[model samples]
Target: MSTDTSSEQRIQLRLGSEAATEELARKLASALDEGCVVGLSGRLGAGKTVFCRGLAEGRGVDPREVSSPSFVYLQSYEGDSGPFHHADLYRLGSMDDAAIEEAIDGTGLQHVLGAAGLAAVEWWEFYRGPVPQKLVTVEIAVENPEYRSIELKFAGQGLQRALDAVS
Candidate 1:
């Protein structure tokens, strides 16, 4: 793992297996505070959902209950800390910004993001709408079938603290 805590701070981790990725995500989740927003960007089969599952587990939710909300666009779970919201925007990639905004609003994503809980959105690059101020972005780069390079950027002090703790 490598970290840069400069003005544009970020943490990068090399995960050699799916389990490692999930474990890292769980640690991050545990360190995060409520009302934090996490945006995940990665290619298909990049373990985004796996990370979400770990995140849910860290928040005291059943990991098996967390899945990619690709079809439904969003899913919500009650966790020990608070509500955990998962959103997927892969299907909206081709849509224009306005349409994407409409879809987000229609799915109640706008309301859930940065609410009194943790919100994670997969394929977050597809959404061009205004994002929550308390946001953390994770970019997973596939190094191979079983390995991934994960980079995280924080946009809030709470998120930075969370990253520090996780790192």
Candidate 2:
């Protein structure tokens, strides 16, 4: 955990195994509140779904029920306190003018954001424009088959406090 010169609190964790990654995800889940949006960016097989599973588990949902929504676009699950929406936009193209318009209207993200609960969006960079201003971004990089580097950043003061507590 480190705070840069800009007062941006950045946390980096080395996940030695998938379990470690899941534990980190659970920690993140603890920091989340109702209506929280977690934006995730990573390459293929970067354990985004695994982290989401942990998040679901932390929310009292069965982790076994969580899966990548790449083909389906999004999946909604009943959480401990509210609903959880997991969205994947890997099928969508870049967020160009036309794409952004489509995403803003047709992607169903606006509805998810409007609803209460934890909304985790994978490939969030594609729809970066319409996401909430207080986005909590998580970037995961796979170093090996069993190792990952997870970086977290919060864009708002309240979220920064949550990150601090979790870190």
Which has the greatest lDDT? 1
Q: Per-residue lDDT tens digits of candidate 2, residues 74-155? A: 8899978678888887877554767765765676778887368888888877774554745678899989898898998776
lDDT of each: 0.86, 0.77
lDDT of 1: 0.86
| Clashes per model (N, Cα, C within 3 A) | 0, 0
Q: Once superposed on the true structure, which residue ranges of model 1 sit more than 4 Å away at CA?
A: 1-7
TM-scores for the candidates: 0.93, 0.86
**Cα error of candidate 2 at position 2, Å:** 15
Best-fitting candidate, measured by TM-score? Answer: 1
Could you tell me which 10 consecutive residues in candidate 2 have the lowest summed lDDT?
1-10
